[model samples]
Target: MAAFSRTASLLCKNAVRSESLGKLNNFCTSARGSKSYQLVVVGSGAGGAAIAARFSSKLGKGKVAIIEPSDAHYNQAMWTLVGGGIVKLEDTYRPMASIIPSTCDWIKDRATTFKPDTCTVSTQGGEEIKYEYLVVAVGLQLRYEDIKGLTEGLEMDPMLVSNYSAKYVTRTINAIDKFKGGQAVFTLPNTPIKCPGAPQKIMYLAESKWKKNGVKKSSTITYNTAMGVMLGAPKYAEVLRGVCEKRGIQVNFKTNLVEVNPEKKEAVFMKLETGETYVQPYDFMHVTPPMSTPTELKSSPLVNAGGFLTVDKYTLQHSQYPNVFGIGDCTDVPTPKTAAAVASQCGIVAENLAAVMKGGTLTRKYDGYTACPLVTSYNTCIMAEFAFEGVPMETFPIDQGKERQSMYWVKLHILPRVYNLMTKGWWSGPAPVRKIFHLGLSKQE
Candidate 1:
């Protein structure tokens, strides 16, 4: 209780500082020459945007800068719905300027190199930005080129689409609409992906769409995944397996997509255990490409042997560099990489980094809390919330593993609004709500 009170008091004092700092109108917008700040945040995705907002307010104007090359910010989570035809692609985009806090200097450039030893970052535009503290929030890079012929296939074959990419997401529904009752295949890659549930989510929605269009009896639906289990969480995995069995969806585990023959309309897969290759012909296919940390990060000294950011899974601070922190998919946190995970990590990064700035002990710790609303149909979803090691940390009192229309409603309508609030530093996930629902008995770590 004493620890909690002290941490709360520290955060309160920081909030007061944020209010005062926000009033300073001095902002930098240049991409050339050398610059410096108290803090420099790389990448402008979920983790980058939220953390930048928090510190840009807390540290004052001209004290913080964000280096990113993209002009538009996207809520990538919505791409699944967009692919399902539940929402338009335009609905998920906000101009990057609008999302970035006014107090922070937006250095519109890509980070090409990181020199943690000197607290320096080199941008592609020949600018050197130095900082007292650094936050690496650069998200994973989707490697569509990794699979043989996959890039050409996506370009030449109208039936080949992936919900993972914004360029190909809209093509998903179109391909589904064009299908005239043939083999429909969906694949999960061998590498870690942003949303582990997304590769299968589109399958469920497509199956539902086929049923609605009277093609369910004629079309065959198959889910080919690289993972041995349906989901990481055993509780949710069991339920998902039952759902697939009931829906007659064939599950092929440990099978990875290795290549796409666009001319032949076939996908080649390799078995992980036996190293055996097989081919599946398809009329329509959804592919989740392999992903990795950005090239700049992978080659840097900040990453681990696996090329992911080397941060303490609990503290989110770089193992070697005390002033360096990481968030989102780039970090080697042993949790499913999702926006929900990023939201939970944002406050931890903010508080711990603030404590570092104050020469105080880091009190906050992240428990790997993440949520995945598995949309099973047009109106039903299973809300899976868990902590480290797949321990269920549900927010509602009711059974969240069960498919419910209310959960789908929340996913469809409420999550996006909450996401926007998170980018603006106004939301910090549903921890408080979970505590209230569980009567203060919810797992804290």
Candidate 2:
């Protein structure tokens, strides 16, 4: 009881000091009475939730606060299967209140602006959250409306689908089911998406579905991507290319989606090679929209020219502000954004952020590790795990870039379990599994 009072008093003193000394105009007056905290985490998704759990557990009551707008938390990772009609959308979401640890204060408001210099954040409801240290895990914002006619087409019948958000993922399955013949087009947007392989993954699932429905002979499938290769890394790309060839999946490289004329059932694409525009008629279109950093973060001084948080790629610490750090898709780190990557970085972030709070040098570092479980069909997947350097960093010793039933099983069954356990501060990365599998072999060999 006494400890709680002491913590509350400290928060009050800081809140008063922040308003008086900093003279932050953006802060809301109502929150001035609620007291300030030492650490404030913005967003409560994968990266935010995990780190919040770690920090709140370490800091105890009144020390940590999470600034989130959503009432529900979701696993964006599993949306691929949801789009494939393998899993229901309802299975992907949970109440945000139930997941965040009891030790932290939950501010159910969107951060309208960030004043990093003063360590103050203003909310939509006119509340001010003052903190000594800040963690930015706001994640990316999907820009579906950026594509011409995409918004209207997506909302209407004969819906052009997307798996990027909960609102639209169900459309992917609907489009696939309705396709009897003609072009079933799937696209990869030019922007950085959370799961780079997801666009093609759904295409494979649709192709498999077409075959199952006995429409394979009549239907034509196409995967148009802006990227030069099927994947970023060479090792995995080699395997993925083979899969495309074997599956008879049409691959169009450097082709980007620019517009959708749903009334005519036409999709317009820009060819990077010839600078030519082409319109193709489609029976079903699965669109992957452009993405960018959240509005508030992009406008702040914290983000770079690319509209992503400028953090040290290895340390997950802000380039300019030592007290501020970022993890997940929001950061300008040169790693593929995925929930698997967020999971691997959580321990490093938790340890390093704690060190920063205690006025200690950062002891832990986050390698640009990301894992993508490439679901090829309903019952098969290729688990591709790699780091920044492009050496295969698989947890299992066997070849990981190959399609396997076991990998599919893991993706459907084990991965979700690990996600639930890990988010609650239980599981770390697969470092132990890696060590156990490769006892004799050198990391390089």
Candidate 3:
């Protein structure tokens, strides 16, 4: 713990400018109605933390304020491993106070209203914050309650669980342990989820676990996805199709989870292509629910027709408000929502937003770089890194499409370390690492 503390402190110092690395308590609890900042970040998640660190260092101390309500910040990307009993939930989070730059003001509250017309927002704490530049990184909100009987099922039966939330993740392990060889069903929802591969990742893990428990012969494993393809990338999709076939895992495409009947131990799914519905009995079920921005935030003027921030897909700047930028799952970026994408977007938002603050026009663009480690088995993974339209923008010299113990080992061991650096604003995505691996020739053209 001491070594981790020392390394984290050193990294934090290097990441945050020396001037903004002090432990000065500039945070305000005053009932003051009017407060102002050079920059006000709406959420303290990955995008907000990185962008705030970027400008706080350049702008010096006390110019940045992050609006977040949580006392603990989570690296939510690791929740899948927690569900699979690979990691503990406590290991996935850190104190928000520790991750947030000490020099910046932490307005610990939820943002209730965004008046972009005046560049002002009202918080639930009854304080109003005004900003010259704003960054919105409020991640997606899960809608587990939207599905009939789902909430009750999650509460009543430990056998029914979800990897999407911390509360239900441990139940997945419990369900696996108590399984007596029936249907071990899993599902993917219709709406955009934070990590697209997470729904099925647990399925693969459960398969391995069941095989280890000697229940593989009797248990029927199934993955029901709302999308037509196994993965958004065609190359990975082709590989995953083979995995499903070889593992004898039934995959139903264009199938959506609509309802769960906890009493009957039945799960109902709607076939998106055929407009048909079916119910299947199950001893264990893992469900991923539809996700969206909070109802109020989605309906606000800050959002586009699609209920996400109306930001340019390239620049991540608001189309309507030049001074405003969007990042993370809440934005209308045409890429799969992942922590890796947010990591790449952080630098872009910081650089481009700084340009805007200097009375300059937007120039930086995001190349849609995102990574998803498809855990095909307990000990192997296929690292899928790409930009728009499934172009093979990989980081390693070796073929990333091939499942290897090396990739899986990194997924379990190294990526969590990278995520720790990322949330603390110490590390950007592997763009530099990728360039170095490509000998500086793989410049994202």
Candidate 4:
């Protein structure tokens, strides 16, 4: 840690400007700077951290500052596996200090407000940070309080579990382990979740686990979702339906979980169509909480009517404020939010942002490439890769709509390496691999 600090200090003195690397009590800095940075990024999650790493490596030290509230970041995608007892929660967390590039100014504070018109961002601690360019990637916030009795039910009831947080993640496995019999329910929220496939993934794994534990005959597994269809993409939707039918996994569409009765062990659900309501007694329930844009981005002048940062969908530039841009889950990009999407978008954003900083026209546009590894069981997964319009934009030559063990292996074994390398700005999307796999069958523009 001391070596890391010394290296950062040396880099700051020689390469970075002092004003851009603002003093924070938590951060260690010994260097001085006079010039301001070219860009400032908010948040340090998958999107913010990856983009910051890319730009800092490209632009060199003293040119970028990343303002983030939390010092720790956990991968939300792997939480399902953790709940299934396939992966540990500790395997998901990475220290923000180690992941972020040393060349970048890491502000250990949250952005309380954004004044994009003035090209300034204010921290929660009342520090004002001005920038020549800005990127918003704060991601979504989980609204656990919106659902009445949901939070209390999760905390008090041992049968209630959620993969959304590490605190409740262990409860999932415990719920499964203690299941002697009865309804094992899993729900998908009414709002847009980070990984759209996560809710169902846990259900599939739970069903498989029940069979292995010899409780399949007694337990009735139900997947209740708010959406009209099983999945957003029609191709994958059909496959999922077939799998559910073959496995006897009952799905109730348009059935949204609104409340919970922990004392009675009953879960209340609302029907979207006829304004009807129903209740089902459950032995276990896994809830995926509703999500919304971060408060700072929502209230900012840079945001749109929808409360998301308004950006040109293709170019990722702020619609109301030209100096501001957004990426990842926080922006209204009309694309699914996933780590794969962040990896692909970071490259394009970095390129366009660098061009803008040099007084040049932005040249790159995001194609809305996003990927979700739908882990079915211990060794099986379906990699659903697509674009913004819900079209099948696969990175492999094979039929991606079908579930495969190879794809599962990639998600479980390979993607972490790809993510680490890519976030460090050493790699991009798997376009090269796709081309090689398809050979002459590659699509032509």
Candidate 5:
């Protein structure tokens, strides 16, 4: 009887080892030219990097993967300051390997196609990546080629510049410095952009610089925007409109920049309301080129009619696929596309995605909290914080709609440090601080 018991125990051990080996063999055969992970995050921007860091800490090494093509991760918010010559462009970015969590596998490749139904992502390098869960944070693409003569204008004309691209951002400061006196035109594209307030921010900064140099008396500044209002939020719009009026800056509403003549220094504008076309010659022009969702996303089945990810606005989960999620400017979240918005959405996406992985209910909800620091001058800013449908969501006890030097200090000094911490998943916006400052009276979703 003792011999029989020993043999039975040996057989049970062998059976367990055989089953494990068989499963390993099957996985190896199925994934011959592909890699697999528990979680895969696409794009290494604000949203992708933050969420990847969060899960990398939770799931441990080799369990998470981040797909990105760029070598550096840029703090794009600093580009505004860079364009204004307040911050160096080199100071805004870090090595991609340094910013990405050490535990997560970094696939240095662009995601060519997303096959949500098959639980796989094909890369430009001819490799397929399978993931148990996926996060799509691929941000917007700048379409400078969409406008005729715009691409050539950026390369050939020294007076024509844009704050939108790193390649052209430094040219903005150069153009501002070179301008003596003439019509200085700033344009806002008709498409949804990364930061809607940025075009105007640079305009204000350039105007302020000109005033300091006594160039303002001779120069005429014009803001030609396609939007019907100065800002989406009425409270902040009123303040911004007042700033423009006081500074004597002319604003043309419902106007779109259609074409540029680099040789003639001419800009063609179309009145969106009437289809009337007009030509305006400028000594200096800042073009915020039209932008759109990435081509890969536009062709994917995961997108809505507007070519944005079809995610539940509150939960940040993909509408059709429970295992898939989205964040930042790529999603159909009805809010301004700012880094602050991405920071607020990070925690919600991380929590809700974890719940989905565990086969549990998604308890966390995003409140559509987005903030845009409207830099009115070199030392003053109107910090506009709001929720969905233009509901004011102020963080400070005092009014945030007014232009304040204190807020400008925060934007220039504090926000950059906070942004670095956020990419590491250490910061999740100012919601808790807002609660404390507001003495628990702040709005909570």
Candidate 6:
């Protein structure tokens, strides 16, 4: 009890220093009191930045306000490469001020209370702001504590790591590079998470790494996932299954991580089918913990039963409240959460919200288009693009399901450029490129 109180005190103290926690704004009386904007964005992530940049420009200066409490904005997708030693951790971030538009007012504080019915919200920095329209882009929150002993396991050893957190990502590179032998385990948790394919991506990278270091035979690689199937998309799942078979990677479906014992180098898994438990000792472990929407958003009226924003999947507008919209991991979009998905949704939200602002009808529709550059090895990747029902939507002329060096290069090179363009509202998605590549054969789905 005393420790918990001390920890809370420390958090309060540090909140003043780090923007993500909270910062007391003593400079402006208006900032602390009631203020208003034409559009208020709840996060400064990919979706929020894109919307703010696009709408703030079109609506004019001071019309849009982004409520974010982070000093440094991260291209979180790059954390995968950082985990695999393909990129440096430092290279993945930029000053939040750089991406947020000068025309848009950034609140620089964490939102504490959301009152969607009244179109008002209270921030941790003591600001009560009202908005004509609200965009909820505050992404999923990681929950390592959901699994007992998981945090300590990550803290104790470099090999005991995860790509989920910025602090733990570098350890993945370290652990993989220094791996000697024995059971190297990777796990996908039972709950909904950001980047569904990332767990296996790292597994494949580790397998490739082991083969290169001549430790392939010495190490027994295993992938344990809670889902009964590997990939959510059927066509892509089939190819991924084949990849696992070809690489001799042992996969246990319907297996979920329940606990960890870092002292024994052991992880406990419960079989979802029969309610049986088992233990596996590991030399290296990468855990993708359960993730959920932020507690504040989850408890708010903005969210649905599952604690995701109840937005129309097509128009990206709130189901009950027409003035509210959602994007990124927070929305109940029914698509895998990825930067590509978020970028594509930005276009839909911007167009529809603009139409509504002008007393116009919402016409722009999102087709659930999403892309995942599944890196199969050091030099190969399957650039899987699809829509609502696992229907393959290839951007290039060739087969997207097949592993290709060209696709790997696209993941390694082209996507970063696209992400940068999207941040500045210059790129909504690869819609135009897709149309041109498909020779005007693009379907709605």
Candidates in order have lDDT scores of 0.89, 0.84, 0.83, 0.80, 0.88, 0.85
Residue-level lDDT of model 1, residues 157-219, one tens digit each, is 999999988788999989888888989999999999998999988999999999999988998
lDDT score for candidate 5 against the true structure: 0.88
- What are the per-residue Cα lDDT tens digits for candidate 2 across 333-380? 897898888987887788887776655778887767788899999999
Q: What are the per-residue Cα lDDT tens digits for candidate 5 across 334-426?
A: 999999999999999999988877657889888889999999899999999988887888888899999899999999999999999999998
lDDT of 2: 0.84
Instruction: Compare candidates 3 and 4 on TM-score and give the better one.
Output: 3
Model 5 ranges off by over 4 Å: 1-33
Model 6 is weakest, by summed lDDT over 10 consecutive residues, at 21-30
Model 3 clashing residue pairs (backbone): none
RMSD of 5: 8.1
TM-score of every candidate: 0.92, 0.91, 0.91, 0.90, 0.92, 0.92
Q: How far is each candidate from the true structure, as Cα RMSD in Å?
A: 8.3, 5.7, 9.6, 7.8, 8.1, 8.6
| Candidate 6, 1-445: lDDT as tens digits | 5764454435433433342211211111112227888789999989999999998899899888999999988888878888989988888888999999999999999999987534567999888887767899999999999999999878887779899987788889889989998999999998888888899998999899999889988989999999888878888899999999998899999999999999999999999999999999988899999999999899898888889999899999888766678999999988889999998899899889888777578899898888888988878999888888777777888988899999989988999888989999888778888888878886643
lDDT of 4 at 234: 80
Q: Give the TM-score of candidate 4.
A: 0.90
What local lDDT does model 6 show for residue 445? 31
lDDT of 3 by residue, 1-445 (tens): 5764455445433422232212111211111227888789988887888777777778878899999988988888888888888889999988989878887899999998986544567899888897767899889999999999999999998899999987787778878878889898999999988989888888998898888889989989999999999888888888888888999999999999999999999999999988899998999999998999866578678897768988888999887766678999999888889999998888788778877666566788888888899887779999998897877788998999888999999999999898877776777689898889899998673
Off by over 4 Å in 6: 1-33
RMSD of 1: 8.3
